[model samples]
Target: MNWKKPITSSLKSLSLSIALVCAGTYIAHAETVGEPEKEELKFGFIKLTDMAPIAIAYENGYFEDEGLYVTIEAQANWKVLLNGVIDGTLDGAHMLAGQPIAATMGYGTKAHIITPFSMDLNGNAITVSNDIWKKMKPNIPKMADGRPVHPIKADSLKPVIESLASEGKPFKMGMVFPVSTHNYELRYWLAAGGIHPGYYAPHKGDNSGQIDAQALLSVTPPPQMPSTMEAGTIHGYCVGEPWNQQAVFKGIGVPVVTDYEIWKNNPEKVFGITAAFAEKYPNTTIRLTRALIRAAKWLDDNSNANRPAAVKILSQSNYVGADYDVIANSMTGTFEYEKGDKRAVPDFNVFFRYNATYPYYSDAIWYLTQMRRWGQISDDKSDQWYKDLAAKVYRPDIYAKAAQSLIDDKLIPANEFPDFTKENGFKAPQQHFIDDIVYDGNQPNAYLEKFKLGLKKGDKL
Candidate 1:
């Protein structure tokens, strides 16, 4: 819908004037960075608040600053979005961190997808139907204010699930996709509470992931989650912002816990492109990453003072398309758990701070560990296999090029990014998981051995 022209003309002129003034000092660097081989690009995204980086990049003229014109379209669902990228209908997409890893490993669709940018962290939550919340409230310990305590554990839901099971009713919950962060987080929470969320024994041809499940988990696309639960088809769902807040707004469900509390600052979605796309359009790849990095920085700038305006842009029909208040509830540094029980959660939807945009191989490995734990990987492989696959899918090399170019232009500070020279793609041992298990990405199999539930070493479904 001609999203490019209005901002492009003005921004391009300004950038050109700036380049001319600094020609003597910057000409050599500019000459080394050639024009984007593919300037006009179409990127796809699901309708969620975390898609804001793509929206902000386009709306803020960051794409134009890189001498590129871009079109951002909201796809119907994650699978459709991934298919669009694979089929060349979409140049790239805001994808689940696991999509590329899973695709490359041949879990679902076989494709060589890779991510140079991670979109955001800690934006998803688990919401139970109002009735389930009612059943659960009695079992949960409360505070002096008579409010349920923060970081409510799924253990509180165990008794409720037991009651439902005794009645011969299966306790069904929904996640957005098999390899989605929502799915893994939901499984982690359920398993920590001693409720088996089930497994996917693909080697045995049972991809339903319902094997030995106490809580039957199925896939419901993000946008349809609230309605799907409201219709009594599902009791709860795990999804990104706006939808979780949508249930809270509609009086249909209560968001029990956010993914932040499940695993602090966990990586969520990523900016993914075909391996061929990155190889063929190296300059374009780096330019797009540069634009996204700038957009992410802008989103998190000034203590998120820009969030309200960003929320307005996301509320428009073409982007997230949710009510401003619903998106703002989470996007603007607070989350509503029960109706009117809003609390400050500054890292609720991280875009740039904590290196949120950097594509870490450790992040990719965490998803793989979850896949293996849940039997999505089916059998044990050497730890090197996990590391090698993560290296193949998460391309920090491209991200580094983009970030370095921005730093060289004095657009961002070097201190804002990892020390690329000394940096290895692994994060330090992470310990904020709901179960309190320590995860050192360098030792994926060791981390897998720590989990009490799901497949471990020498275990197969």
Candidate 2:
């Protein structure tokens, strides 16, 4: 609970000054990184396409250019990936945006995890089994061509849930983790449609998060989602691609909606490292961020001109381990909602543009608000407390230093990043949730108050 100690220290602050000085003499208008304190670095990631930044950084030599020798390995799942970083087996990893927030807040793991870079935005989707889709299809309005309408709302599934309830069967669903964005987004979508996705009473020793539930959600890894649903273990799941598209390809399930429709340009995965790692290797931390920033720019460059090449790499067994077409279904600026119902959604997988890589405090606050909203926080908290906790976990100061160095290196155009001078870390109020809720980071307690199905100030489960 001692989040008061700043994630950065005097030595960490000095690393930026030193990098700037070295940039002046290294090359004409080029900011060169110093020799890394640790050169042999191994990073961990789950087998999801959102881990593209890390793979691209390694394949494109962005990491080597920063004097870092990197090895990228696929972890078994989120817990293994997080544990790899926490135990120092992996230097850093692609993480759920909520993992660091939850870890720092003492929700599941009590480690001080921090993220200097957000990996990408809007790459997850909610998919349902063929049977459930068949039942929900009648409720969803169809286009003239008989295609189910896009951005399918969970309201269409309510009658199905009720029917199952009448038969004394629980409506089952899956998300990757308790604190994952997938879990929150699925819960939000279900609740917006008047279905109680349920809550967690950690204080009551229930991490099950199934207290008073209508749709019972459980953890299922990304790659296993389609098979799990196929086996009737769960009816559907919310997970990042190519798992969703894999379901569509296998003909086992149909994706109901994308996270983009749930919350536009929502912050997704982040590059997470321990606070101890950041403090001990400040130069390495900034250097890796710079590399990742470049990789992200490449992914979104020329209006995603590099996606085909990126998808080819992600299809490798050591990376996402999915077919190129499955990865490309969404990564190439379009998404397949139902088979033969593909649609153009250019912003479906944003890496760099819209300042997607910057570790914004507002992004951190949103996840914290969801935790509070769903009773994971377990108590009412002051607005300032939310703000303080966000500041502790999201290191925009580190992000700023890394960004400025990229600008200095002329590696990425200065215009590609946020204006560090005027940046106060909080984004303007976001109003993109499917529920029509407006979220202002500075007023998190107020934001939580707006949700009918979640905990708010003075409310306990």
Candidate 3:
């Protein structure tokens, strides 16, 4: 017919089709998304076994699975670790549950730090130096075998504090940080037995926390607690593992009671970041939370079948660095107070069971109440303010998102978590304190009033 014209039209059609295919491929290539906002991150932690969830996340490839490159650095102390997170030198870090609260509230170092993950529960104990333990042992009730009663209360130490005061000597106790769980737990134990742990009045320029004191509480690094007590620098200390176990090994001190005995399943360390970091990398934040949730679940899964292996990982010189036995003393579901006094404390280091990783507002409010109790919060904040701040900083919504994503992925079961649909961020009134005084996080002011010691409503320093 008309071969040249037909051939030319056919060639044009072929070229157009080829061009369309090329353009489609180019569009698909251009639309391919990049990785989440930030991928490489540095996290800080103390050399304490309670920092296990962070270590497990990094060591078990959970972070890599999330496309995150993480570096875990052991910090010199809590203050330096917190400062690193605040200045963006570190992305996030393991922290005391109260660090974010006190920092956000302008207590120690003012920074808008927050945590979506609570690290673990109940890894700390109140340890008295050998001499003090010797003196306090007499007051402690005896067992059938004549061993000092277990879970020795602060009342046992009252006469020692009194005798020290009578001799014009200050009775000193060490807590790792002013805003640490150790501080509150130690103070709670002391006050429960009628030993005043002084006060903190930032408004009065006395952030020392040693005003009107009965027992002087001060700061000591966690790892140094045993040695400091040995040197006679402090009489007793409240610190997290494996330092308490370290004391038993060194034969320098005896751990009288654990924080678990003081308050069962209490929130201990948390994984914290500055609000600015979280805001800048939202997806990265959620991904990191997801990894941590997996780590925590792995920790408590199958009734802590993985803890022995975890203790081995933690005992490596790079991590917690204590002997395997020392780390295992508490990590493997039991704790040692005096050298041979090993007791079955299955919840000594709760990583997941009992919603240990969930950042509950009630947990935050409880810490706030303790801060107010010891004067870390100088002014009289209304009860609503406490609840509001707890709600703001302890974001259960963010936690639920990470947890639900894990369940959706079949990484963990629905039974492993609190019923997110019905959780109000408040725990059902806790009655587990050593004092047997009920602590309902909903009624913080009234809870404060129940304490014969500590700051109360309308009471300013």
* Candidate whose lDDT is highest: 1
For candidate 2, write residues 1-461 as lDDT tens digits.
00011122232446764784587622122245454577678899899999999889878767756667687788888998888999999999999999999999998889999999999999999999999999999999989998987778999999999999999999999999899999999999999988999889999999898888999999998888889999999999999999999998999999999999999999999999999999989888988898899899999999999999999999999889899999999999989887888999999999999999988999999999888888899998888988888888899999888888887767777888898989999999988889888989999888877887877678897
| Ranked by lDDT, top first | 1, 2, 3
* Alpha-carbon local distance difference test for all models: 0.91, 0.88, 0.85
lDDT of candidate 3 over 1-461, digit per residue (tens) = 00011111133355664784687521111011223478778899999998888888877767765657777889999999999998898999999999999889888778888899999998899988899988998898989987777678889889998998889999999999999999999999999899999998887788888999898999999989988999999988999999988989999999999998899889999999988887888777887898898889899989899999999999988788899999999999998878798888889999998899999899999999999888888777888999988876787887887777777777778998999999999999999888889999889988999989988888887
Poorly placed runs, candidate 2 (over 4 Å): 1-33
TM-score of 1: 0.95
Better of 1 and 3 by TM-score: 1
Give per-model CA RMSD.
3.0, 6.3, 10.6
* Model 2: pairs clashing at backbone N, Cα or C within 3 Å: 31-409
lDDT of 2 at 246: 96
Ranking by TM-score: 1, 2, 3
- TM-scores of the candidates are 0.95, 0.93, 0.92
Two-way TM-score contest, 1 vs 2, winner: 1
lDDT of 2: 0.88
Quote the lDDT for 56 in model 2. 90
